[model samples]
Target: MKRPFFVVIVTVLLFIFACNQSVKVEVVTESSMRDSTQLVFWKNLGDLYGKAFRGTVVAGGDGDTTFAGELVMHVRLVEEGVIKVPFIVGRDSSRTWIFTLESDGLMLNHDHRHPDGTESESNMYGGKTTNFGTAECQVFPVDQATVNILPTRTTNVWWVELVPGSHFTYNLRRVNTDRFFSVRFDLTQEIETPGVPWGW
Candidate 1:
C-alpha cells in the first residue's frame, strides 16, 4: 500500500524534530553537569568563610625561607561570586588570594599590598580555570595579565584543593621547571582570625 505523500512528509519532519530536540537536551545536560561541579567546588571553599587555619609548606621551598614563619590562611570574606583569603606569614600580612566567579569558570588573583595599604607592583597576577575541574580541586594556568606582569612566568600554573573538614592546599608549578610550591592547611583546626590583610 502506497502512503500519501503528505503523510510521509509529516512523518519525516517529526522524526527530524525529535532528533534535534534530543541533541539539544544532551548539550544542555552536559553543560549543566559542568556547572554543577563548579558550583560545588565554590561552595566547598566558601564554607570556610570567617575561619582561619594553620598551614605548613610541604613541598618545593628549599631555597625560599619566606614560608619559614608561622603560616595562616584566614578565609575572611565571602560575597556573591567572590572569596577573599588572606595568607599570613609571621608578621607579614601583605598577600591575599582572591577568587572570583566568571561566566566561563573561576578566577584566581594574587592581591599583594604594602603595609600602609598600598598596592604592590606584582599584584593581581593570576589565572582562570581552563576546564570543568572536580568539586575538590580546580587549576588555573597563567593568564594574559600575569604574562604581562611577569613575562618569564608564562608557564606558571596554580591549583587549589579543598577537602571539606580535612585540608586545603594552595599549590604552584612553573611548568617544565624545577619551581614548585605547596602549602597545606588543616581544616580541622580553626585559628584566631588575623588582622585585615594589608590594603584590604
Candidate 2:
C-alpha cells in the first residue's frame, strides 16, 4: 500500500535533517505501526517544525488585551532532542518557548529573552507532562517555579490542540481567574517565517 502524503513529506524532511547532522542523531520517530500517541503527536508537529504558523486571536485576556494582536509561531526541532518554538507578537519578538524530552515526559520551558540576547528575569517557567497525551492534544500545568512567577494565580494550564489538516490551537488559562487566552491557526495556510526571535 502507498503511504499517506503526510507520511511521505515527514519521511523526506527527516531524511534531509538526518543527512546534515555530524553527531549521533537522536531519532524520535519509529515505524508507523509502532508509533505511540506522543510519537504521532511529535510527527504531526514535526511536519510544520520549520514553518511559520500565523494565527488570529479568538480569545483575549483581562478585558480583551495582549494576545489580541497578530500571533505567529515558528516551530522547529532545534537540537538532537529539543524543540524550540517561538511565539512572535505583532512587533515584539521577545518570547520563545522551548521543549525537550525528559526521562518522565516532555518538558516545556518559557524562554523570554530580551532583544539584546539576554534572558529575562521571569523566563523559563513551564511544566512537564504527567500523562500521555493523545496525538491531538497535550496539556501542561504550571509547575512550582511557574507558580512562584505569578503568586496570585492558582492555576496555569497551557495546552496545544491540533486537528490534522484543519486547525491548531494554543490555549492558556488560570483557573477561576480572568487570565484566559486562545489563539487558533489555520493549518491549511502557511505564512512567511518572521525574523529570528530575540536572543536567537
Candidate 3:
C-alpha cells in the first residue's frame, strides 16, 4: 500500500512540473488601448449656404451596431452681420426655438430661414444653400477646456470637432432634433444614440 501511494504522489508531481514547463504567459496593460499620439485641430465654421440640406443624416458607430436615420433637416439664421443662429429639425417637423450663443451667456437671435419663402418647419437662419453651389455657415471657436466637453440640452447647443488637431475645437448647434438624427459629413465623425451623450 505504501509503495502504491508513493508512486501516485511522484507521478502527480511530475505531471505538474511538465505542465508548468510548457505553459505560455502574457501581460496586457490599459495604456495599450490608449492613444497618446492623436493630434486634433479645429477650424472656424464658415457660413453654410446651399439649396437644401441634401440627403438624410445617417448615424453609425465604430462597433458592429446599426440604427435608423436621426436628423431629418436643419437650418440657421444669419443676420446681415451678426453671427448665424443654428437650429435643428425634429422628426415631427416642428420649428422649435433654440437659445442662441453670443459673446457671453446672453441670449442671441434665433435662426429663421426657409427655402420656399415660408416659415421653416425646422429652425431657420437667414443663410442660404443651393444644390450645386456651396453654402456658407459660421464655425464656432474651440478652446482647450471646451475640447472634450459634451453639449447640454438645457443650453440647447453642441460643439462638434469638424477638424481635429492639437487644438481641439467644435461646431456649435442646438440639438433640437430627435435623439437619433444628426448631420452627416465627410469632414469629421458625428455620433449620437437614443440614450448616449450628445458628443462622445
Candidate 4:
C-alpha cells in the first residue's frame, strides 16, 4: 500500500510541474520596449553603413571548420528601415544577410548567391522575430521556406546578438539535435573591409 501511495505522489508532482510550465509558456511579457530597443540598435548599425567588419569564427563545431576562417560583414545598404548586410565567409563572398523592418517584428533572410550573381540552389531562407525579445537579443525560428528548402533543417533556428561596446554574435542551432554554431565578432575594433562580394 505504501508503494502505491508513493507512485501516486510522484505522478501528482509531475502533473503540477507540467501545468506550471505550460502556464509560463502561454504567458510571456509582450511589451513595446522591444521596438524602441531594436530601433536604437538598428540606428547603431546604420551609423556604420558602408563599413565592412572583419572578424573570426571564434568558436563553433560540427563540420563548420570552413566557417572558422576570417569572417566579414559588409553593411552595404541601409534605407528606410531596411538594412542589407552580407556575411562574407573566408574566400566565399556569396552570402548576404538581409534584415528588414517588420511592423510586428524584425525579419532575417539569408541571401545566398553564386559567383555569377545568381541565386544558389538552396537560398533565401531565414526567419522573423516571433516575440518581444529584449533589445540586446532576439530569436528567430526557422522559416517555412527554410524547412521546405532543406527538410532536415526543420528544427533549425538562428539569431544575432549585440552587446554595445563589446561583441556581436551570429549563432545557429539545430534544436533537438545538439548541433550548434556561433561566431563572435569584436565590436571594439573594426577591421578593413574586403572587396565587393560576388554579384553584389
Candidate 5:
C-alpha cells in the first residue's frame, strides 16, 4: 500500500510540473504574437532616424491653410523608446510628432510649442493604438486628453504609414465627418536636417 501511494504521488507531481511548463509556454507565445506587429512597426520607424524627408500635402488641406507652405519632416531625435519627428510647414517649426512605446502598445503626441520654447495650449494632445496594427501602419484614435483639449476633435483618428526606402505618410480622419488630411514624405531621397523644433 505504501509503495502504491508513493507512485501515485510522484505521478501527480510530474503532471503538475508539466502543466505549469505548458502554461508558461503558452503565455510567452501569446505575448509574442500580440506584440509582433507593433515591434515591427516600431523598428521600421526607428530605422529612419537621422534622416530628413520633404513632404507634400496629398489630401484635404484646402480648408486649412496651415499646411500651405513647403512641408518638411525631420526624423530628428530617436531614443530607446521615443522617436521625435519635427514637422516644418514653411517657416513654422513649432510642431513635433512624438512617438512613444508603452507597455500596451504605442502612443503618439503632438508637441506644439511657441518660438520661445513655451508649451502651447494644445500640446501633447494625441492618442494611443487600440489594436495590433499592421507592420506598415498604426492607427491612433483620439484619446481622452485630446477630447479635453479640443472637444470638437473627439472623433479624430490619426495613422502613420511607412514603406521602408519608399515613402511615409501621415493621415487623419474624423469618424463621422468628411474631415481628412494626408501628407506623404519621400523616403527615397534624404534631405538636410532642419533646425531644432520649438521646445525641443
Candidate 6:
C-alpha cells in the first residue's frame, strides 16, 4: 500500500512540473517610419539608381597583392527623400550593408563575417567599416540630408553635388598604402518609387 501511494505522489509532482513549464516566443520590431507605397518607391529607386563600380586595389605588405574588384549599390529614398543605400562589396571578399539616416543620425551598418565563421557587424556615425578584406567601405555626409558619397580610404572630404533639374557629379576615391586611387560610380538607374517592396 505505501509503495502504491509513493508512485501516485511522484506521478502527481511530475504532472505539476510539466504544467508549470513556460513557452518562449520571439518578437521583432517593424519600422513605422515609411509606408508601403513610399517604401516601394524607395526600393524601386534603389534598383533604378543602382550601379556597379570596379577598381584596382593597391595595398602595402611584405608582398603586395593587387586585385580588381567591383561593388554594387542600390539607392533608395529615405526619411526625407535622402538616399538609403544597401550595398554588397565584392564577389570574393564581400560584406552587405544597409545605409540610412535617422533623425539627425547617419548610420552605417557593416554585416560582415569573421574568420571563426560568425556574423559580425559594425556601426558607424556616417559610415562604418572594417579593414578585414584588404579594403575598407565608408560613407560620408555631404549636405544636411543629401548627396553623400563613399570615396576612397584616403579621401578626407570628397563629396557629390546634386541639383534636381540639372546634372550632378558623384565622386569617389580609394587609397591603399598612401596611393590615392579614384573610381567613378555612375548613376546607372533611377527609380522614383520603391522597386522591391518588403517588410510589414
Count clashing residue pairs per candidate.
0, 1, 36, 0, 0, 15
Clashes in model 1: which pairs? Answer: none
For candidate 1, the TM-score is 0.85
Q: lDDT tens string, model 3, 127-146?
A: 11111111122222322222
Candidate 1, 161-181: lDDT as tens digits: 999999999999999999999
**Candidate 6 local lDDT, 1-200, one digit each (tens):** 36798898999999999999996866432333233322343344344344333322222222433324443444433445355444433443333334453443334443444434355442221332221111112234333222233333323333232322232233333323353333333443332332232210
The sequence of per-residue lDDT tens digits that candidate 5 reaches over residues 16-109 is 9988884434455646755678888899899888999999999998878989788999988889999999999988999999999988989999
Is 1 or 3 the stronger prediction by lDDT? Answer: 1
Q: Which candidate is the best by TM-score?
A: 1
Candidate 3, lDDT over the whole model: 0.31
Rank order (by lDDT, best first): 1, 5, 4, 2, 6, 3
Q: TM-scores, in order shown?
A: 0.85, 0.76, 0.26, 0.78, 0.83, 0.33
Q: How far does residue 5 in candidate 6 sit from its true spot (Å)? A: 99
**lDDT of candidate 4 at residue 29, scale 0 to 100:** 37
> All predictions: root-mean-square deviation over Cα?
5.7, 15.9, 16.8, 10.8, 6.9, 19.5
Tell me the spans in candidate 2 whose CA falls farther than 4 Å from its real position: 1-35
Q: Estimate, for each residue in 74-116, the C-alpha lDDT of model 4 and write its tens digit.
A: 7888999688888887788898888887778888888888898
Measured by lDDT, the strongest candidate is 1
Q: Which parts of model 5 are misplaced by more than 4 Å? A: 1-29
lDDT of 6 at 19: 91
